[model samples]
Target: MSEPFDPARWRPAAFLPERDVRDPALIFAIAVLCFLACLTALGVIAGDRAAHGWSGQLKGEATVIVRARGGETPDAAAARAAETLAGVPGVSEARALEKEKAYDLIRPWLGDVTDLEDLPVPRLVAVSLDRKRPATATVLQEALKAQGVDAVVDDHQIWIKDIRRAAGVVRLSGASIFLLIALAAAAVVAFATRAGLAARRDVVQVLHLAGAEDNQIANLFELRFARVAAISGALGAIAAALTGALLRLIGGGAGITPALPIAWLDLLAVLPCPLLAAIVAVVAARLTARRLIQDL
Candidate 1:
């Protein structure tokens, strides 16, 4: 049976050992960082979507506060203004809100009104802007003035600006955190590579004596650590995907809370984590190995 052994099937052994005792701990640490990074990416996606949604809704609308002039009732004046605005170009729909809605709007500041009927509360006209050609605040004002309606228009420019600013802040914070996590993971891998090189110094010296180049030696460590990081990244990515799936199911498509909505498609972002982790590890390990070897 042994006589049939083929020379063609022979394979050379790796310069580095197949596995190290410290592998489990290193994998665990790197995996944790990958998991956090994946989660951060998902948060950023959800937050950005939420911000765009709120801004889009506000962009397509305008509010008009109408004050009754002369002896006309507030409702009659508001109705007249609505009619006037409805006929204006770029105005999709214009209608006067009920008196109760106006009272509700004021209740936050004035609390419950005892003389609600006596108070001349300004009526609200909600104007839907045309998607293709929206009306400007100046245009709306001019139209209202020409019709002799005393009104003030709020185009939600202030609210939209604030939302966009907050969204930018969120995106910046998430990116910073994700960057820090990646660096920490790289640092851990670099440290492990240095430790490995130190422990294997005798083997490195023997290989050097046998005519191995510094880059050749460094490549061994790079391949070893890259494999470890890839495995860790896969584990972390799978865990993150499962957690995201659970959240999406619980919250439905819109997310659990209105603030953070997780969509199923967002989970796809983790798909590249393994390759990214491997690349980071390869760079970190190569640099650390070469530096240590040179110092030796």
Candidate 2:
């Protein structure tokens, strides 16, 4: 036989049940948003790295188009320009590309041309610059002028500026996307809190009349939903990190694409997601619960 219940030993049932039937749906939706946010953060980091890499490569080199003059052969003019550019203080090395290299550059436009030597094709010179103190276009051009070699220098200044602008755009776009996802997650939690309060109106009324303070009622939902969001965040963050790792493994050291190389370190960007999710949930749940509870 069961013992009789004593008033002193009786404990009240929780205002909200330990688990709700609708929580799984809420968790799934929030988790998907968190996953997308993490991926966006990782992509932003990788894209920034790629843009910097391309810019650095362009900055450290220049090109020259050599035009023959005053009875000089194309090859002789190119070699003279290369030697002149090599003597510049900031230039590391300068070499004239072979005729075949020039043919490959123009073959697409000119179609098949077996007797390419007859046409007055200008020669090209590739210049390597010193990393610590690279040569500028004006300096290079002056050096060629001093040697009486007619050539044009392309220092890639225009290309580098464009790449930097692209990187800034990528960063701005990523931040906007992340903010949108966070707002979406907060909205979901707020709606869920409101629905939960509406469904348990009678219980909330009884608790309020029984001397439970407004903050106490709000705190209960705050802690409960915060825990749920924290767990969901972990799930989503783990999934995103795993996807990034797979790309890193598949691409090996080079990464999935040259433009966006996923690094193992980039996966760490998702680490703070759980805490952020909890904070958003706490604010959302507390505000929603208090507003609806006060009306009752």
Candidate 3:
């Protein structure tokens, strides 16, 4: 007597008892892949934030270095340059740094020497420009020259350009890493699906002979892989979140900006990694089963 089909009594994974042993390795691989993908996504977010921060801080700002010569002190030269810059059309404000502060800036490279004051350190003038009517380095230099102040203008554009280029490289590298991890995850799921199919070949052949559809057989593999992937991916995502949090805490303690900025919008990008991993596993399993089951 043929029993009626009852969805509640059907469990596809029951076809092979050995799946219990093999599934752990597959799950672990998926978890590692998910961890790497999440980390790369976080890296992309951090690079974007850092690039924006650098651009915001450096745009429309410049530095003036006043050289001391002909019996003029660095402070006097800096003061004259600041006074000249104050009247410039595009310049908003200028301030001369004190000698002690200047010495502190170079203390990192040159150790504390008692004759530090004797060193001819050029005075530094920080200049702010109105973005609406930005001042050019050439114009600032001409203004300083007209006032007989020997100074060099650094508009910081070069540094900003270098920072932007570096950010681009980081973003590209992160994307490449993400792609490789995703490919590796798909390969792992495919291999596991094929192994499971082989282990249950006899059952699959009987089901095929008994008039089961190809998709029906494929579903058996997909469901198993998808469930495993979801659990493993979630574990990996949690680990990544904890790691990011720890790094942020360390960065805060060290008085440095964290690579991963904690923002709701940025975190939203990371939240989908586990779900995407599950989807990848499901699709890989389905495709692998469909192709391999045809010979059965």
Candidate 4:
């Protein structure tokens, strides 16, 4: 097993500060900003997918639309097709569509169920295939033809493919956005660390003149910067979470489906982000200090 990282004992005081445990406010800020952005993006992507994918579960029930072709009666054709499908292998249940039920399906767009009487609503059969090795279109097609019903199969795979592609795009976009956010976070840390170092330059100069090692001076800055980063990161994360929750509540509706819940796991999963920000600040500080010392 890989050993855990011990920041204190891992390097000299120049790289690892003794007083680093104070607070990491700035680091926390950057991390929380990134985490919130990531979570929001994820939620948006998830909600879109869930709504599109699970809207109507057609997989569990196969629909056979018997066209009113030739001199064949639509009702008769549907009944014959339903009987054939029910007898087919791997078919658990089959039923011919009742006129009231068929009209109700079109009632959404056509207004009243009575309005669909003139519409050529073809004979319909609802079939439930056994879970194991469900019947295929080829088998069902042949059986329907034998029963004198012109039937077509719609498995909804084409639309599902399009949705999957959209999901891929969403995930890719989210990744890219988060990457940019992280870069921004690193830049912020670098800037803050430089500012901190500049403010303490006189103290550092005095320490150096007093025969204190470069490592000792570096340690003080690292500790201070790390603390600032940590605290800031935590605050940012909390704020992000609260904002997300509020938005979720605002958008909550029976008709609306969210991608995923903004749970503790996502929040907790990125808790180490603040530490990473602090590390960036510390490194930036170290590099600036080295440059300053060299120029002297």
* Model 4 ranges off by over 4 Å: 1-63, 68-73, 79-120, 125-149, 209-214, 248-270
Candidate that scores best on TM-score: 1
Estimated TM-score for each candidate: 0.89, 0.87, 0.75, 0.66
Report the Cα lDDT for candidate 1. 0.86
Cα deviation at 155, candidate 4, in Å, is 1.4
Single out the weakest 10-residue window by summed lDDT for candidate 1.
185-194
**Per-residue C-alpha lDDT of model 4 across residues 218-265, encoded as one tens digit per residue:** 777777776677666656656665665565466574222345434333
Ranking by TM-score: 1, 2, 3, 4
Candidate 2: segments with Cα more than 4 A from true spot? 1-15
- In candidate 3 the C-alpha lDDT for residue 208 amounts to 76
- Candidate 2 TM-score over all chains jointly: 0.87
lDDT of 2 by residue, 1-296 (tens): 98997999899977678898888987898888888888878887888788778888998999999989989999999999999999999999999999788888999999998879988888999999998899999999999999999899999899989987887787788778777876776676666666766776676688888999989888887888888889888888998899889988888896878888888999999999888888888887777767777787
Model 2 Cα shift for residue 108 (angstroms): 2.4
Stretches > 4 Å off in candidate 1: 1-11, 109-111
C-alpha lDDT (0 to 100) for residue 54 of candidate 2: 82
